[model samples]
Target: MSTPASTSANQQQTHTPVGLIAFAWTLVGVPLAYGLYNTVKAASALFGG
Candidate 1:
């Protein structure tokens, strides 16, 4: 038996805003870049100085 229309699957899509996505990336990328910079600095110190 087919389901009722009230119980049917939704066809609409939810989208994130571009500004919000950019803000989220900036939030994640800044600390990630900082951590990578620190790791590279430590590795260079260990290998050379």
Candidate 2:
């Protein structure tokens, strides 16, 4: 049988540093933003907007 304390200890949370988290988001966000920009550009050209 597992005690509550032992169960909680086993599930200890790991943390990522803020700088690394920001870098990871930037990696994902840059490509996403570029893709969205090109998509809107192409769509505007097609619609003559």
Candidate 3:
């Protein structure tokens, strides 16, 4: 009825488990990226100014 990938995708949605991990990763990634960006900005400000 469904392809393997589709089946897995359906299962993933039905259980809604992996999405939590994905959401957490997104939350963590954004903050981590922002922190790194700000750190670089601070260093540049200190050195270049």
Candidate 4:
């Protein structure tokens, strides 16, 4: 049901840029890592680890 041009456009839209993917992961990962590190530190202190 799709024409060639429209198909190519769809394909382009579906493909995400590598930089954008990395940036998104970094945006989420930094905060997640920070929270995890603090949690582990707190747990260690609580348990005398």
Candidate 5:
């Protein structure tokens, strides 16, 4: 007796927890931060400072 809308609603993707999302972003962020840090370091060397 379920309508299409009701069936689709039941099949919706589950929500990821806030903590897990943050952790996933951190997993991406760490390497990015390191790359930026190294880039800045290399750029600073060109200025001889």
Candidate 6:
């Protein structure tokens, strides 16, 4: 009765949806963090602190 090996190959999905989202978030977060850091540094310099 174990004659069908094709069922196991087609039953699973190999795509990861969360991993793709995390990767995208990291790509966008790097530049955003740099912008925030520079903004704070500029403010401090303006006040002569």
Which candidate should be chosen as best, given lDDT against the real structure?
2
Candidate 1 per-residue C-alpha lDDT over 1-49 given as tens digits, one digit per residue, 9 for 90 to 100: 9867654365566899999999999999999999999999999999988
Question: For residues 1-49, could you state the per-residue lDDT of candidate 4 as single tens digits?
Answer: 7567666556644678999999999999999999999999999999985
Per-prediction backbone clash count? 0, 0, 0, 0, 0, 0
lDDT tens per residue, model 5, 1-49 = 7567666657778788999999999999999999999999999998877
How high is the lDDT of residue 45 in model 5? 98
RMSD of 6: 9.0
Give candidate 5 misplaced runs (Cα > 4 Å).
Answer: 1-13
Best by TM-score: 2
Model 1 CA lDDT for position 45: 98
CA lDDT of every candidate: 0.91, 0.92, 0.87, 0.89, 0.90, 0.89
Q: Give the Å shift of residue 37 in candidate 6.
A: 0.4
How do all models score by TM-score?
Answer: 0.74, 0.75, 0.54, 0.71, 0.64, 0.58
Q: Report the C-alpha lDDT of model 6 over 1-49, residue by residue, as the tens digit.
A: 6767668766876777998989999999999999999999999999977
Residue 26 of model 1, lDDT score: 100
For candidate 5, the 10 contiguous residues with the lowest summed lDDT are: 1-10
Clash pairs of candidate 2?
Answer: none
Q: Which stretches of candidate 3 lie over 4 Å from their true place?
A: 1-16
Could you arrange the candidates by TM-score from highest to lowest?
2, 1, 4, 5, 6, 3
In model 2, the Cα lDDT at residue 40 comes to 93
Clashes of 6: 0
- Pairs that clash in candidate 4: none
